[model samples]
Target chain A: MAEEVENFEPKIVAFLCNWCSYAGADLAGIGRYQYPPNVRVIRVPCSGRVDPLYILKALQNGADGVLVSGCHPGDCHYIEGNYYARRKFAVLKNLLEALGLEEGRVQFSWVSAAEGERFSQVIREVTESVKKLGPARRMVKSFEIPKEIEKEIAEA
Target chain B: MDIQSEIQKIAARLLKNKEVAMVIGYGAGSAPNRTAPVFIDKEKDVGKLVFNRFCVNNLSLYLPRLKEKGKIAIVAKPCDVRTIVCLIQEKQIERDKVHIISFACPGLLEKDGKTLFASCAECAVTLPPVYDTLSGEAKEMERNEPFTDRVADFFSKMPAERWEMFKAEMEKCIRCYACRNACPMCYCEECFVERSLPRWIGEGSEVTDTMIFHIVRAIHTAGRCGECGACARACPMDVNLAPLAKQIREDMLNLFHHQAGVDPNAPAALETFKPDDYNDFIK
Candidate 1:
């Protein structure tokens, strides 16, 4: 049972902006850098397009961790998309932290297209962090109806 | 003259002169110490308009609905005026088409009448920021505490405790959307909650669904919310939804040095960005 538990791999959802972070991840692949295969990447047009709902939905739908990566400040392909995204991410992070999802379950990073090695490093770190926290039990929706509510529905 | 009578006279004059199509203000509700929104088209009905601590509805919520009805005269509190400013800034309503009659509020009492509402206690403006006409004396009130005091207190709690509190708060939601309806800023024709094709959130009273509904709503109102406390007050279950909005508002001030509804001509915080905006979290 201990070995089975130790072998558990965390499922991480990564949202990478099309301009910078996605290319960075691609470069990581081209470089053949070895990293955890736990991440599932979703390429967005820009970091600004990554709405808080997307992150929340990922967690709700059973993602063990979420990583949102974008262009560095002043380097957005859209000029200021990452700037707006920065403000939004700050607020969302605060709210999520306050709601108790552990410290590193959700993360943000700036990875340029040229920084392939950095991309792999971020993924490895995120995977390890989420692995340490184990599977997310809170905020994941359980489809089962409560016995009391089931009884009420049957009676009605 | 007392503030109540002055407001009535102003509303009456505006209606009598046909200067506006209608006047939106508060009137006595069925229960004692309750006030309902009253629309007065006739000058004589202006007497129904009253001002008191119980008049807690952010009257600005009615502006967008009445936009196409022609020129309107709205009786606005300082906080309600912020909503008007936001609506005008968003172009939901034409500034020239509506006349504002604003008042200096001392503070408002909760429905119980014994204590001041949390929003009222934290109010930074006693006088309307912009108005065509004004009433009441500007009473000096001091805010010894920070605007984000309540949110900060909640943030200081352990993650488990905060999560438990959040769950407890969201559990009472019945998906009525009264909070949305009562908000002036929530004027989206196809609210995300109602979307179907790429449905953002499921329409269910389950805890996760309800939480998603609220979390999205709160995020939608991030820098745009005027902090009128209408959403929280409108919830029949008394769920405290304002803190989420307030937390964002605090962030807007701290991160961007911006406050919603303060300057009509200024661009929204999220719509504009500085290259050097705070981003230490982005590693």
Candidate 2:
């Protein structure tokens, strides 16, 4: 079990805004940039569209790490969507940190459509940080019956 | 004159003139040392209105529900008035329809009447930000301490210990949703929690679900919470919800220098953003 635990691979969920970060990831793929295979991408219309609930839901569903990326500060497809998103993200990040989650478990970054290399670099960094932290235990919901309850059921 | 008789006189005058269709104020609850919201439609019942240390309910929570009833006259503390400002800014209620009778709150007492609710103890705004009439002379009180001290202390604990504290709090939540119901800003016709087509959150008091519920609720009310302490007061389990809400308020002030309900004309912090809002956390 110890040997198996040493080989643990992290699962990461990345929420990328459709106009920029998603395009950047696509460009990374088209450019054949090598990056970690840990992240599963979900494209949203805007970074502002990613409710904090989505991040919490990903964590609650047992993802080891979550990343949210969007257009650069002044470059949102919508005039000021990323600007609004930046504020929400700051508040959410602070609240989550205060709630006691490990720092690197959730990340925020700017990845424009032109920066394919930066996208891969962020993925590499996020994967390595989450791997160092190991699997998330806090905020992960367990559906399995309690051991005592299982024992009682067996006796009954 | 005592504040209670003053409140009764004002309520009677409002009812007598038919200036308001109804006046929402506090009355004695069935239990000792408790107060309940009373909706007085008749002038005679103005005598039932009371104000004291026990009037802890943030009556603005009822504004959205009562807006359709008629033009309303509400008794508001400084904190409750903040919620009213939020409600109006959110377009949940119109500014012109309701008459606000606000007072200078001398901090609320706990059931014991000695200790103050955490929100009230550190309250800086004792006078309402907006009111149609004044109930009493605005009292001068010094705000010496930041209200987030306790929350900041909790945040300083180890990660494992903090998680334990959060889990313990979640375990005590019975999903009564009194917190959501009591919040003036949570006036959605269809809350995300109730949506079934694409159920956003699971309906359970399980630890993770409760945590999600709270986190989502806190984020939703992030810049808008008036710090009225109504949610904490309404909780039968005493769930220490102030810290979570206070954390958002602190972040708003720190990041945007914006305080909710302080300026009715300014856009909410989350709804509008500055070009150079803080983003040191972003890569």
Candidate 3:
């Protein structure tokens, strides 16, 4: 018989757009959905409000996984906000992948307020995937230069 | 059409001077979208010099490396002309040794590519406001705000967020160094990044290594940048860093009231120190 493996709890960061995704997550909570408790939600007004830098920062700050959930396509309350985010994230994803980030480290999906079940399912899935991946090594911010050395650039 | 005959005539006149060795200008490529820098040696080749919407290279980056046989003539667009003005002001080159046949610029076209230069989108092409000889369309008026409001919006980003944006951009860098090579003001004999004794950048493309290269290059161009937007155009990753350039331009102009490559006599912002140079904001 194969050895029974222990289920791991992943540390996930969800950037939810305030208009729809956040409301969906809230509905999931009110409905007593058995979603994973690993996620720390940051409520932003629009998906465009979630800049790619914010994702990088979360990863640097030790997020095992990042889930950027927004309103469904053409559904952003702030007309065309998601369109900009779509362009930027597409670029950001390629850069991260080029930097050796695995496919599952960062994921984007759309979850509307009408789909509380989908939001619950996504959180649970992201948690499981990240648990398998262990942690994000590429996102660590290891570039801090010493102050005196930096200050003496002209003199040096 | 506006500049072809005029440039040919000027190149002929410049070649007559014994001290002048060459005339650097644009040549017709295979099509309308193409233009290349032509170094004119023979007077007959002067007819080859032409200017149009496609004449885009800043070309000043070449001047510092050339072991000039004698005085050279350059086809001066307003931006390249601005670069020359700064170089002359810095005594990097002798102004009299070169003849500048400045041409009125309508604007420049993007190199035939999927990725278009964003700077061309923001270009006013007017406040290259002065030149020695100009040809092409009727000159336009200088812009008052020009290229600042965008930088101001980016400035409103939280410092942490701003740093992250920069990180994301630098992360995409393949260490091509195209941005540095394309910059007209980056004409150091031995650039700080390449110094063996104290290499400012590591010799590899580790994220941190590339971050140093970009941060230093951007800072170095601080007040010297003429906002030509050449650096961002040369980037393969589409990491448009023009906001940093725009910010530096605005800050220098605001505090020092100095515009780079514009005035023949203006000193570099860092060089001529003033006891009363604004210190109120500095802690």
Candidate 4:
């Protein structure tokens, strides 16, 4: 179990807004800021584009952690995208928490296009928080065949 | 006059005046403990309209479904009126297209006819918030604590224990969309669950699928659920969905100071945002 914990690298899905967090990540790449590579980033046009369904789908599809990063308040390229996103994510996060999901399984942050260092720090913090919680077991959908179906198939 | 006779007289007057093309109200169900929604188009059918303890269904659910049927008058409980307000606020129904007929609700009974619905115990509104005409007089009834306050016991449990409880409740769901159908707020043209291109919910009653369905539904109804208890009563599996609804309701009130169905003109909590809203959850 000790070795398992040591070797278990968590898979984190990060949805980054195109105008800010995505560019922030690009800056991080250009500046050679070291950060964990476990996060797979999906760039959306705006933070508002990150539907709660997308986050839940990521968690359901076996991702250990999910992160959504957008521009700071009043910094949205679309004028008020992140403001709306902030409300949406706040409620989504609260709902997820109420359903008994671990505190770190889903994370939200605001990273501007110039904040490369902050983006790396945010990723590292999110990754460490998720690592402590371990793999997500709640709300994950396993695609394995049922025991009854498997037995029937074996017989056939 | 009794509530039923008053309701019938109102329905007859509305139909006789041709003010409403149809009057959607409750009629006797096959069982004594149940009431089914009935549409009264002619004055003769006004006698069929009844308002009793068995009138538990949220009649506003049919407004959006029957939108093209022309102007309609609905017999709504005070709680049901909240859903109509929510629908109007969401632009799902036009306020002018429908007439609301409500009365002082005496509260509703469970299907067994012996116990009061949990929603009734916490009900705060005895008079409809917005109505074209109100019928029977409302007598003040003692109200208990808010539903969210009562669910604090469930929320206070350890996260792991709460998860176990949620999982247990979710496991009992047979994936019947009765809860969705019964919900007035769930009037989406294409529900995410039924979309095949990007199937939001799994095919069968897998625990994960059921959990996601409820989670998304709760999110969808967050500030919009009127606490009408229609979804819980519609569940054939007897799964208690009140905890999740109450939790979202409490969060909406705490975070945005918004309650669903209270004001027809107020914007929905999720549809609009305040620049200085709470962001303590964000990093």
Best of the candidates, DockQ = 4
Please provide, for model 2 over B1-283, each residue's C-alpha lDDT reduced to its tens digit, 9 standing for 90 to 100.
Answer: 8778888888888889988899999998898788999999999998889888899898988888889988899998889999999999999999988899888888787787666778887678988888998877877655443233456667778988887888888899999999999888988989888889888777888889899898889998988988888898889998877668878988989888889999999888899888988988998
- Fraction of the reference Cα-Cα interface contacts (below 8 Å) that each candidate reproduces: 0.66, 0.77, 0.00, 0.79
Q: Write the per-residue lDDT of candidate 3 for residues B126-161, one digit (tens) a residue.
A: 535545555555556333322323344555676446
True contacts kept of 2: 0.77
CA lDDT of each candidate? 0.85, 0.87, 0.69, 0.87
Report the lDDT tens digits of candidate 1 across residue range B52-125: 87887888888888888899999888888988999999999999888999878766776676777778777788
Estimated TM-score per prediction?
Answer: 0.92, 0.94, 0.59, 0.94
State in Å the error of residue A108, model 2. 1.0
Query: Global lDDT for candidate 3?
Result: 0.69
Q: List the residue pairs that clash in candidate 3.
A: B102-B133, B104-B135
Models sorted by DockQ, best on top: 4, 2, 1, 3
lDDT of 4 by residue, B128-216 (tens): 88898778676665644323233566678988988888989989999889999999999998999999997787879898888889988
Q: Which ten residues in a row have the lowest lDDT in candidate 1 chain B?
A: B141-150
Q: Write the per-residue lDDT of candidate 2 for residues A17-136, one digit (tens) a residue.
A: 999999999999999999999999999999989989899999999999999999999999997989998988898888888887888888999999998999999899999888888888
**Model 3 chain B poorest 10 in a row by lDDT:** B141-150
* Model 3 bad stretches (over 4 Å): A1-156, B17-19, B30-32, B112-117, B121-130, B141-156
What value does the lDDT take at residue B268 in candidate 3? 66
